[model samples]
Target: MQTISSCVEAIVLEQPFLEEALSKGIINYSALADVLQDDVSQTLGKPVKAGAIMMALRRYKDRLTVSKPYYGLNALLEQLGDITLRSNLSDFTFRNSNTLIDSQAAILNTIKNKSHIFYTFTRGILESNIIISSSEKEAVLESFKNENCIALKENLSAISLVLPKHNTKVAGLYYQILKRLAWQNVSLYEVISTTNEFTIVVEDTFVDSAFSIIKNLNKN
Candidate 1:
C-alpha cells in the first residue's frame, strides 16, 4: 500500500542516475510521471494515476534536492592533490586460467625492479584483463611470453590523480568528476577507485587536456 509520495521518494533515492538528472533540471516531469506511474503501480500491485504521480513528484522535488548531499566540483577540486603523468607504457591482457597463475607471478617479479607506471588485475568469468605497465616494451614482452597472453598493446599512458578520502555516504562525487571528462570527449581506458583515492587511465594524447579539465574543477 505505497502512496504516490512514498513511491516517488523511493524511485528518486534508488536511482542515482535519475536523481542526478533531476538535480540538473534535465528531466521532463510529466513524461517522468507517466513512466513512473507504471513502475509504481507494478510495485504496489495497484493502479496509480499519472496525474497523481506528477503532483507527488512536484511536491517532493525541493525536499529531495535539498536533502541529497551535493559534492560540488569546486569542493572536490580542493581535495585533489598531485597529478602524475607517465608515458612509454604498455598493456597486457591474458585469458583467465589456473595456468596463468605462474605467468602472473613472473610478470610481478619482472616489474619488481623496473620503474613501472600502473597495474590492474581485472577478473571476469570468460576472461581476465590484466593491465600492467613499464617504460620498456621489451621488458614487458620478455616477461609474459610463455604465459599464453591474448594481446599486448604498447605506447599507452596513464595519468593518476590523487584524491582525499571521501565520505562513503555522499552521492554523485565520482559521477561529478566523470561527467566533466565525458563532456569533453575524453575517453577513459580504466578507472581505479579505492576508499580514499581515485585514478583514471587515458591515452597519452589526452593527458594534458584531461589534467587541465580536472584541475579547473576547483575554480570558482
Candidate 2:
C-alpha cells in the first residue's frame, strides 16, 4: 500500500540534499511537509493532510537521526596512512589497439632502470592512460608513436592516499572524502583507486589546496 510514510520515504530518497538535511535535522519539518503535501496526496490517490505529512517527516527525521550514515569513518580519515605527492607529471591518453600492450611493455622496459621515476598506467575499454614523470615523457612518446594519441596533459601532480584496509566495508567512504574536495573547488583531472589505495591527479596549481583539504577532512 502507498501509505504516507512510504511516499515520504520515496520522495526523500529521490532528493539527496533533502535526505541530508533530514539526517542532520536542519530543515523545518512542518514547512517541508506543507511543500510535499500535494505530492503525497497524488501518490496516495487521496488528499493527504499537511499535519499527517508533517508527522511522517518527523518520524523520518527521527530514523535518520538514529542511523549514522558514516559511523566510524571520521577516525579513519583522521588516520590516513600516507598522503604522498608526485609533481611534474604528464598524462598521456591513447585509443586502445592491439599493439598497446607491446608499447606498454617497451615503456616499462625503457624506464626499468630509472628508480627515481614515478609512473602509473590504466587501460580502459576504449582508451588507455599513462602517467609518468616528465623526465620519462620522451620514452613514453617514442613507445606510443604509432598509436592514436587522443590527449596529452602536462604540468600535473598526483596525490596518492593509503586508504584504510577496511575501506571497502564502509559505505560513502569515497563520497565523504571527495565531497570536501569538491566543496573547496578543487578540480580533478583523473581519479584512480584500488582496494587499499586512492589517487587523485590534479593540476599543479591545485595540488596544495587539494592536499590540504584532503589531509584535514576529519577536522571538518
Candidate 3:
C-alpha cells in the first residue's frame, strides 16, 4: 500500500507547475486535496478521503518545496544586452547522405557572408536532420538546390538574447526563461543554446511578443 506521504511526493514531483505553486505558498490546499483525492485513491487501489489527503499534504509541505535559488542570477540578468531581431530568415533541412557531407563546405561558404546564420547538424541512427538558417534566402536556395534536401522552410525570424556567463552548475535558469515564454503562448520555431547566450527563432509576427516575454524574465 502506498502511503499518503509517498503519494503526495509523487504528485509534486510529476507536476512541475504545481510544485512551483506549492513552494511559493500560492496553492490552495483545499482545492489541491479535492483535485487529487480521486487520483490518489485510484493509484493506491482504495478509497482515500480528501481530509486525509489534506493532512498528508500539510505533513509533507516542506518536503514538497524543493526549489533551489540560483546565486548570481540577478547579476547575470543585469548584463543582458538589448534584444536583436532579424527578418527574412530561411530554414533548410537536408537528408543525410554522402553528397550532403560533401556539400556542407560549399553551403557554409555561401552563407558565411550573411549578417546572421544558425547551423545545426543532428545525426540519427538511420538519417540526419541538418538545419541551416540565414537571412539570405536566395543564396541559401542557390547553394542547396542541387543537394539532397528533404525539407525546406522559409519566412522565419530570430530573436537572440545575449546573456552573461553564469555558473553552469546553477539549475532552473533556462527553465525560468522558457516558462515565461510558454505562459504567454509564444511558440518557438527553434532554439540555439550556448554557454553564455540563448537564442530563439520565431515567426516574424511573434518576434515582438517573444522579445517582450524574454526581457521580462529579468524583472523577477
On TM-score, the leading prediction is: 2
Superior by TM-score: candidate 1 or candidate 2: 2
lDDT of candidate 3 over 97-142, digit per residue (tens): 6666656667678767764576655565555454555445566567
Q: Report the poorest 10 consecutive residues by lDDT, candidate 1.
A: 68-77
Q: Over 4 Å off in model 3, which ranges?
A: 64-67, 70-82, 115-135, 146-148
Over 1-220, each residue of candidate 1 has an lDDT whose tens digit, in order, gives 6777897889887876677677667889899998898888987788988888878877777776686555454466677777777666666777677766676677678767765446666666756665666554565566556665787766666666677665354566677778778878899877777776677777777877788877776664
In candidate 3, where is summed lDDT lowest over 10 consecutive residues? 63-72
State each model's C-alpha RMSD to the native.
3.8, 2.5, 2.9
Q: How well does candidate 2 score on lDDT at residue 79? A: 66
For 141-169, candidate 2 gives per-residue lDDT tens digits of 89999999999999999999998788787
Misplaced by over 4 Å in model 1 are 9-15, 34-47, 71-76, 98-101, 116-129, 165-171, 183-185, 203-209
Clash pairs, model 2 backbone: none
Model 2 per-residue lDDT at 38? 91
Candidate 2, number of clashes: 0
Best by lDDT: 2
